[model samples]
Target: MTTNTEPALHKSLGTLQLWGIAVGLVISGEYFGWSFGWASAGTLGFMVTAIFIAAMYACFIFSFTELTTSIPHAGGPFEYSRRAFGPVGGYLAGFATLVEFVFAPPAISLAIGAYLNVQFPALDPKIAALGAYLVFMGLNIVGVQIAATFELFVTLVAIFELLVFMGVVSPGFSVANFVKGGWSGEDAFSLASVPGMFAAIPFAIWFFLAIEGVAMAAEEARDPKRSIPIAYIAGILTLVVLAIGVMLFAGGAGDWTQLANINDPLPQAMKLIVGDNSGWLHMLVWLGLFGLIASFHGIILGYSRQIFALSRAGYLPELLGRVHPKFRTPHLAILAGGIVGIAAIFSDELITFGGQTLTANIVTMSVFGAIVMYILSMASLFKLRATEPGLPRSFRAPGFPVVPGFALLAAVVCLVAMTYYNPLIAGVFVGLMALGYLYFLATRSRRAVRAATAV
Candidate 1:
């Protein structure tokens, strides 16, 4: 029988906060710019491309909802993989996931700097980048409550910025921009080749990536089964709908090419539609910046938990597992996150290898990492269905084999689509996962040796 002295299992995260964190990390600020750029790259119609991205995203959410409820733990995708595939597979999946988080902050922080540069030309990008990091650090250090509150605030600001920018400039819209003969010279609106669509899918996946992090919050949730699913479903659908609306409005408004070319699309859209120098639009642009800050805060919290989990499992340094008694936060993991983010900043500042710029390359790699996790995590569902039918699930994936089966198919299609779209980075992701598997083996060997010596 279980003893009363056993450690408590629940954590403090609320349902609303759970949704905010999920949405904040996945759909905030410049991510929309990335999504817009990627979706626009496809041969599909404006609405069609956006919907396709949204649909793929939905599958992930539906699939993960069941897993999160079944195994409400802090490890996120890693935890699910470990349960289904055993230790080594879990560690590798989690390791790949960790790599994505570690790389993401710097890329996002750099994006924030770029947006700030567009708005305030006098400010140095390095300073802007540092400032972004400081803000991320401050929010996370203080507490998750403040962090969640800020995320909620940013979510509102992002939504407002979208509505105002789109509404005000919508009058100038013209369907002519899209009709200028599609990118292929044959009605850009036409869906012609599978090859082109395949090429566009990776870019699209990059935009829609990171929805899986929401499911991981189940361990911290006040109500894991109820909250994870609600947050995952609501947050994703909200972002996708708002994203489509923003895209449609911008495309129709006027001069889609100018907005696309602009380093920061939202601010550029505002400038073009409302006549650039308008103070209100500039202020609104900053508000959009607020969204990025919010997203960063949520991501750091989620990523740290992943780290904390890995460390507990003996895969990472034990120092990472320590939690601050005072703040009740993973202080060491948070610090590690900050350090990695700083390194990322410095690396980004220096690197300009290959034909693509540093930021572009990171974006490509980040997308690849995310898609790998998605494909693997979705595959886990089938494994769980067969191996662990006895496991209790709080929230079930609707339609059983049908819904999950379709999700599995969608994930495979996305993988194929990503590979065809940018084979270089897709290859890199495979290499990275292989390296993770190797690392796991090495760690296991070291542990076994240590145990033998002790015995």
Candidate 2:
């Protein structure tokens, strides 16, 4: 196993490229997952839910930037928690990050399959999904610069497509369409809709799900101290605007119920505006693939770093951390994540007790992971602020204790809310974490014994 850490990755990313990395990590999110919120809460309720979630993320990102710049490590939340709370905390943080970064790609990969099928009706979506995994993983393994440059290109395309979507749908956007009958077909908001609004939190979170992933790339950044703040602030602004715009337009474009649970909400929304065979629908569907591709390729890059950092620190098998001799990338880790994602795509038809699709179940499980990481990371930030008072921070979170506290509280609420709404999905996630922690325990003791014996 190659454990050398002196030169693990090429240091070539700048502010613009980092912006690409951050934006690309989550642009696909704006296209699909958030609409699932509408299924439970309807358009207006989901919109209200989205606004709160967006505020939580805004606070989270500001706090996370301080952690990234102060530590400047590829381990992200893992590194931050390890410093503040020790080994067990590190494992939980790392495992949550792995779940967040690794599982997200499968969801995006499935969307890629759905988007491709729009153009090629004969192609099997399963094959297309697996094909997306193989192709993007290969690109990431080649080199970070190439992968990042490609990310920038596709992100720009995705951004332009969003602008075009908003323009095309704006003429047809009626506030009445978005708000009227938007409360799950009920006359008005009631006590019963409270659970639904909470249930919608996870889907609303999808709008900016992995943008904090920029922190994972800090170790490879040319000037993470300065660039990190710029990347994060700019990245969140981009997403917030995009999220609100897309959600409002998508909801207002048609019979909001038709879009609540689908994989490709944008194309469907456009079809409603322009009819079944509009030339606009065909163009948007093709360009929309860029949005999905941006997130897929960027996340593979982020998860590889998460894997590399953990394995190198002995949290996982050292071989999984091995850097490619020529490419200087975590090739094994990339392939491992890819294999698991391909497996998920194949098993995408499973159902939860709530009759949610495997994709919905997986989405809930991934949100659980994000919630865990957010709570820990925010706590780490609060702890570090008190303990490491003079840690030479380049960027400080805006409201200090208040901001991190709000983020922590918001994350805790989301965690409890989602678990209450989706008990089966919650149980499955807890079981998975238990299995991983067991592996960690066995390996940690074995390593200690080996060290003592060597003496």
Candidate 3:
């Protein structure tokens, strides 16, 4: 008697899906919060932080391009690690990543709720949060094709919204805003506040946090080796340019303080510049909302798939491994992810890595998880290359061991820096990772026992 192996299902994401993940992760709702951090950093600090963040992201993308092309499987980093380092390493990489994605949607949904609350004081955060989850959950559960289409629409609108804000608000910007003092308190111009600039660098770092989604989408990309590299390079360059444009536009506007405080700074900046009488600001607001929604959908798509992939590999429960028969989607995992976001309504408010004053507890948790996963993935790259030089690389990271080496170093530095600055929330992240690793060890012991019994 022989056992039959399960057949594998493949995803061939087109340019649209490719852009969906790329733009979605880069042009995030997180930016709304990031602007405050950048403004507080002042011009030079902002520029420096932006460069550091961009370079780090480039390294990650380049490294992932190599790994993604080789495996080109659904597991993303999880699959790459399993192939290179075996099951335990894969589990850790995948587990850390799952924690991030599972918890992130709620944080993003909370952002939507927070923004909606600004316009509608009566809008309950919970209700708005739940609504956001349903819309995106439905999109994911329905299928990737529909989700991809929706993401395309949302990203397009987001681009238009950003362009409109930039075009309309340019004339209203005052150079004086850039020179204002105490960017954090009114002492920004004071030499004593120099630390504030260093404090502000993390904000830029936070903006570039999720830019790795393009490489993560390797499993679904139409051509992993080719598409992954193109998406990684083109997507990042486009986003960095856009980010610089937004920063310059904001800096040029007279009162950085005003932009820093507003929930949706671009629309408010447009209002301040062009006057509230213009209907375009409202249109831009709606478009911006659409952009946020698009971001929401894209993350859910990518994150849920990450979970499904890991689950299929036996690192998670099989339920998460199920693909909807009709929709060809990860229904259970998508639902599970949305539920976490829905639960985040009850969680505390937590400050984000960006200099922003606050974010939902869930979002902060996800950000921390993402950071941890990045560190793991980068380290894995270094370890795998050293341990398995003979392995074929369809795409190679430029600068040899230097690229992966630097990425690992950057990951360590950022983690330490983020922890130093935001110990409170950062502590929470550490706690979660500790708990996850423990669970990993526990499960492994049980599996070992089972294997022995079978023998």
What are the per-model numbers of colliding residue pairs?
4, 0, 9
- Alpha carbon deviation, residue 335, candidate 1 (Å): 2.5
Tell me each candidate's RMSD, in Å, in order.
3.5, 2.3, 3.7
Task: List the candidate 1 regions with Cα displacement exceeding 4 Å.
Answer: 1-10, 29-32, 35-47, 183-194, 261-263, 348-354, 445-455
> Residue-wise lDDT of candidate 2 within 132-153, one digit each (tens)?
8989999999999999999999
> What is the per-residue lDDT of model 3 for residues 378-418, given as tens digits with 9 covering 90 to 100?
77677778888887787888997888778777767766766
Tell me how far the alpha carbon of residue 61 in candidate 3 is from the true structure, in angstroms, after superposition: 1.3
**Total backbone clashes of candidate 2, pairs 3 or more residues apart or in separate chains:** 0
Predicted model with the maximum lDDT:
2
- Model 2 residue 147 CA deviation in Å: 0.7
lDDT of 1 by residue, 1-455 (tens): 11232122237788888877777786653334453343345223434444676777786688878888888777878878877888876876787688767667766777678778877889876678778777777667676666677777777776677677677777776667544533433453444533455555544554556667776566767778778888888888787877666666666655566654233666666666777788867776677676666666777877787887777566777678776666666777877877877776677544434444566556666666666677667778879988999888888777777766766677677667667756676666677677777767778865454335552
Q: Candidate 2 — which pairs collide?
A: none
Residue pairs clashing, model 3? 106-341, 173-253, 174-253, 174-254, 177-254, 181-188, 182-186, 182-187, 182-188
- Give all candidates' CA lDDT scores: 0.67, 0.87, 0.66
Winner by TM-score: 2
Worst 10 residues of 1 by lDDT: 1-10
What is the lDDT ranking, best to worst?
2, 1, 3
